[model samples]
Target: MSRYETVIGLEVHAQLKTKTKIFCSCSTEFGKDPNENVCAVCSGMPGVLPVLNEKVAEYATKMGIATNCEINLKSVFARKNYFYPDLPKGYQISQFELPICEHGHVDIEVDDEKKRIGVTRIHMEEDAGKSIHSAADNASFVDLNRTGVPLIEIVSEPDMRSAEEAIAYLKEVRSVLLYLGICDGNMEEGSFRCDANISVRPYGQEEFGTRAELKNLNSFKHILKAIKYEVDRQIDLVEDGEKVVQETRLFNVDKGITQSMRGKEEAHDYRYFPDPDLVPLVLDEAWVKQWQSELPELPRDKRERFMVEYTLADYDAALITTDRTVAEYFEAAVKAYNGEAKKVTNWVVGELLPFCHEVESEACDVKLSPEKLAALLTLVDDGTISVKIGKDIFRDLCESGDDPAEYVKAKGLAQMSDSGELEAMVDQVIADNPSEVEAFKGGKKKLMSFFMGQVMRLSKGQANPGIVTKMIQEKLS
Candidate 1:
């Protein structure tokens, strides 16, 4: 424990999945040739004017409703003036005075304690282009393809007291975006990114200390590392009687330290003014109601429901409900199996999830369907195949999408449950391991596992464990 308390707030930029740019008709598709998606409006031509994309408003409003925000009936767009090579337009259009959403909050759990973090606002804006630097040529290039892309910046209050709480809150927000199907939530591709503002003060101080904004935090690992490093730096400066300056710093991935980028600017520095071309956006009541109706069950609600409906433990329910697709997959598998929900939960969480992760795909996109997985589990339920054998062939079934019963029959991998055959195998194992048998009869009952291991090896993992255990006990007794 330290004498200072850490305060953290996150600003997240999530690129909306729209077919075209926010203010222009140019396609928003990524990974095309340089300037392939550019147009007169997006390129900032002299005579072009921007038109708001209706779909962008709908998406933003839906997010606001999902976060328990108050959807303002009318909002204004203002020009955020700045100078950069990637920003072709001298001023980027963003909302400042009255955003579309305000006064919202989301709940998160850290260390088994639930906390609600305040969402100050979620506002819409246009994204700037990319700047690519070529070391060989000793030059930098700008690609305007990403210019005019739609984004919503969710700003959180300084409600987090530690990095763990900040991360938990971020994950909760990302999960909501994913569940709403409004954003792709891809951190590596820049579709989803974060900027963290950190400050430190004495444990009882009410006033906040000078803060530093950290940028270039691409992934969660980098965010966590940056927060930890920045917190310590601020504390050291305070203890040494040095002032912590307010500025923007970039996190160097290799060095794992923050380097000052530039002095942080206040809103007045930008000279913000209402855009002359675009008018105030007034949302219709019916339109807002329609979006509200279409909102799907959020992650937290679904997680609680899974616990009561399926009798799942908290860990299993939380893992399954983290993503909407995985939850749907679990429900579909359970419906098809019509057996113990826990049994289906075990296979889905233990086997299917790992396989999907290894192949880099979602639960819905995996080659193995829920029905096929239920079929595989059914074979084990009926004693037609051993549990070990089912696990061994799971990967192959996921890849090939073969029928479980047919594959078991074709490969001669059925469990050895016949009385005479199992008895003989058990007898041979006892005769071979006489010392182990004597040990078991002499009260080293744990040796029963050793006998079972031998029988399983002899039968090539196809032995019925229950029957083998019974026969080994009788012979030894």
Candidate 2:
């Protein structure tokens, strides 16, 4: 219970996955040879008029609908005046007074308590180019390939109280964009980026402390660390009778501290005005409804549905729904095996995710497809193999891309479930380990694991573990 309460709001810029730059015919491919993908229009040569790309509007409106935002039928795009070497036009064209969407909300959970954060507006904009600095030579380079790329800036209300909430809100927005397929959601590649505005006030104070902008937080870990440090710095300033200043700050990755970059700018500072070259974007009600109906089920909705329909717990549902392909993979296996979602979830979350991590590939990219995973789980379900042997079988199937049933039969990995054969082995085990058996009968119940281990070792790791446990209990009792 500190005397201060932190307030946070996030602005996420998601570059839409359009084939071409928003207002030009230039290709939007990344990692092109520096300025290779640039054209006269994208590079902002004089006497060239901009033509709006319909796909940009389509993607932005789709995101608005997905985030439960109000779609402004007649949204205007304005010129945001700024002069930087990377901004080839000297002024970036963006939406201002009449943005494409407004009044949206995203719900997030922290410590199992749900909160709906308000989205103030979602506006369309064109991305500026990159500025490259050379290490060998003391010179700067500007690459205009990224200029004129379609972007939608999602502005959130200042509802977050801590780093966890801000991050949860950011992740939810990224997931929605990813699910929509409008954005690649790659933060490292600059496809998705966030700038946070943070402020603090006394616990019962009605006025807010001046906020500082935190920029260039590429990773989640960096974002979290930055917020924690910023909040503490503001609280300290207030306690020391120092007033916090409104300025832009950069998060230093190596030093793990935020340094002031520049003073925060207001909307009026951008000198926004409607572009005379381009007309207003007028979306009809029928057209907006069409895209709304076509929107995919978002991550949050999918997570909730999994909990109810698949009978999965909150943690499993969240883990599986973290990415679209992972959720699809889980659903495919469940459908193939005809239910048993809990078992499927356990394997997918416990086994599949880690395997994907080890290979440094997406879960959907694995050779172990849903059908194959279903087959492996079926082998365990039918008692053809024990869980221990299934581990080996799963690994072999992944490595060799072989069918599970064939692999089991070819490798002699089937669980030996025969009672008579197992009983004889149990007798041999009990007879050989007299001291352990005596210890087991002398009220040492925990020694059952030792007997089970010996039986497994004697059976060459093919013994049915459940049957071994039963036989050991019968003999010991």
Candidate 3:
């Protein structure tokens, strides 16, 4: 271990799943034509007064409650002054001194050890437009479609000590956002993105080393790699008797290094002042209560319930509960199957999840409905189809959403349990491989697997292994 320790804090910006801009009626749709979704308010036209979207405030409050944050009865929006081509207003409307949420925390587990990462604040802000650069043409274009999109910036305390801890904390927070159905958590499309603040100090030091803020970490894999790279880079500077610069850096994904973008700015640099056009957002107690009442079972709670109620292993429970749709699918399937929960878990985690990932869709959107999945698993459990046959037909089941029993009958895919048929296949295997049969009789009982494979192949993976094994053993023994 190195003598120095790494401290990391993350600022995650999650785009609200709202329909319109935070302060305007313009659509908050992604991938629209340039400026198509823009209006005078979002485009920063002169003399246009901004109107606060009630849905934005409500969404922000829901997130605050879900994260265990203290919901401020009154929060003020301030103009964050900045100059960028994408920021058409020359200043962005954001919350500073009186953010909507504060003093929240998320618990994360790293290497089987639990740690709580404090959420310093979750402030609501309006997003700036995208600046698409055309390197070939040596020009940049601004798309105001994303302007004024509602965002909640979740800032964490510098409580993490390692990259592993940082990643675990990020994943936990993202899981919560996904479970709440507030943010889509699509890191690739920038719905959810994180910036890392990294510093290294000696083992006994009380003061922190100069920190570098890493940006452009759009994915979790990139975040982990960037954090590790930045930590090592800072340590190298310190060891070489060079002072670390406090600056903003962008991760060069291809080079796997952080390059300085610009010097970091202090909060006072933004010249934060409350916007006069919009009144202070005062959330009513009744409204807060209603939002709180609407809160679904969060990820941690659902994970715990899965363990106790479903008797799932911790790892399996974590996988199922990571996404709300997947968790709901599991419960619905279990209820529909009305069988062992672990059995449903196996098909879910082992088969269904892989298909979901492959198709880049959630379980809720997939063709394999919970009832359909339950029916398929029921066929496997009832011995109507062998496990191997179930595996073979799973993709078809997922695509066609066909009744498993009906599909089996239509495809002639039922398990072959007849004594006469299985015995003939087993005898044929024994006759075909005399040396293997002799070896089995001479204490090479493991050759039973070899015969079983042949019999299963003859039946096209529909042979009932239980009866086939009994017949093969009786003949060979």
Candidate 4:
């Protein structure tokens, strides 16, 4: 039996998809030259005032609404004083006491049991500049391009019991971010990032355990592994009668361990105080309502709709609606093919997904469009090509973006639906495989598949499987 229960909460910082920085007019675009996107306000030059970006508030409210957070009509920005080199201002302007949104929850399921994880608060803040290290040159560089990027910090309650639950929650949160068009949720590029505060308590205990905050876990796999390692480390400390220190730790992805970075600091250590330069934001009730009205159909709603309207199985619906682009691709193909939802689902999930994985990209980067996929499915439905050959054509579409019909015609890969030709091949297979035929006549009904395989092989896999099955069954009976 396990001795302890793991508890995890995540602090997710997602860079909002705004065109400009939170306070300054500097560009928020990623992958720009170091310091090129910086400005006097964002780079913290002397005597510059910061102005709020209206779009950041709008996006944050959209998220709060989506996550069921209460919109705080009035909120204040505070200065969190810190001394990291990347912090140009020697402090970060953030929301501390009065955040923009509060008391929300996100639902996640693990092992078929649904759990509601409470979101503590969602506050708007500005991102710090990045510090680039170079081991070869023994030097570090600073890039202020991301210095003033708008970010929303989503702090969750310590409600997760295991790594699986944590991952499920993160995925849902990321999906919501994507669906709202607020963030790209790209961990590689730091658009979306997570820091986990994890601890392990004795099972059934009401009090919480000593926790360590794990940072630098950029990917889902990294999150899972880091949580697992931290939990085990804490539990072992307890069993050994050693005290677990509360501190900040960094995940060493290469070594699969967490090392202490610094002692955890209390809120007072940062000297949190209201920013005197910026005025408290007073949001209009009408404006908040307008933002809510413009909210798009979120991922969970879209998943349920896909199951109902598309008449899809629960698994199919979940997989199709997991990503916005993939969901749109499924719907577009279904529409173009005139509502053959199940057929299109099969092709997209089975064939197109593997092709995407092979090419190291997502559905959005796919070269095959819905119109082409619809045309390919039409060929299979009309018996112009076997589903087997259509799979081959799907591969061609994935690789080269060629038209499916043109590929089939150019390669002479049309299905052999001609009854006379299939019948002759079926008879020849029956004669050549006398033992199998006798076994089938003697009661081995499964031998029909053996004969069908032979017929299909004889037809070079171009035979319409339906027609060949019918023709083969007739000759054998």
Instruction: Write one digit per residue (lDDT tens) for candidate 4, span 15-129.
Output: 9999999998998888877899999999999999999999999999999999999999999999999999999999999999999999999987677688999999999999999
lDDT of all predictions: 0.92, 0.91, 0.91, 0.90
Tens digit of per-residue lDDT, candidate 1, span 31-131 = 99999999999999998889999999999999999999999999999999999999998888999998999999999998889999999999999999999
Q: Worst 10-residue stretch by lDDT in candidate 3?
A: 468-477
Preferred candidate (lDDT higher): 1 or 4: 1
Greater-TM-score candidate between 3 and 4: 3
Best candidate, lDDT = 1
Clashes of each: 0, 0, 0, 0
Model 1 regions lying over 4 Å from their true place: none
What does candidate 2's lDDT look like per residue over 361-405, in tens digits?
A: 677788888999999988998899888888766766766788999
RMSD each, Å: 1.3, 1.8, 1.1, 2.2
Better of 1 and 2 by TM-score: 1
lDDT of 4 at 317: 79
TM-score of candidate 4 on Cα atoms, chains taken together: 0.93
lDDT of 1: 0.92
TM per prediction? 0.97, 0.95, 0.98, 0.93
Rank by TM-score (best first): 3, 1, 2, 4
Give residue 256's lDDT in candidate 2 (0 to 100). 88
Which of candidates 2 and 3 reaches a greater TM-score?
3
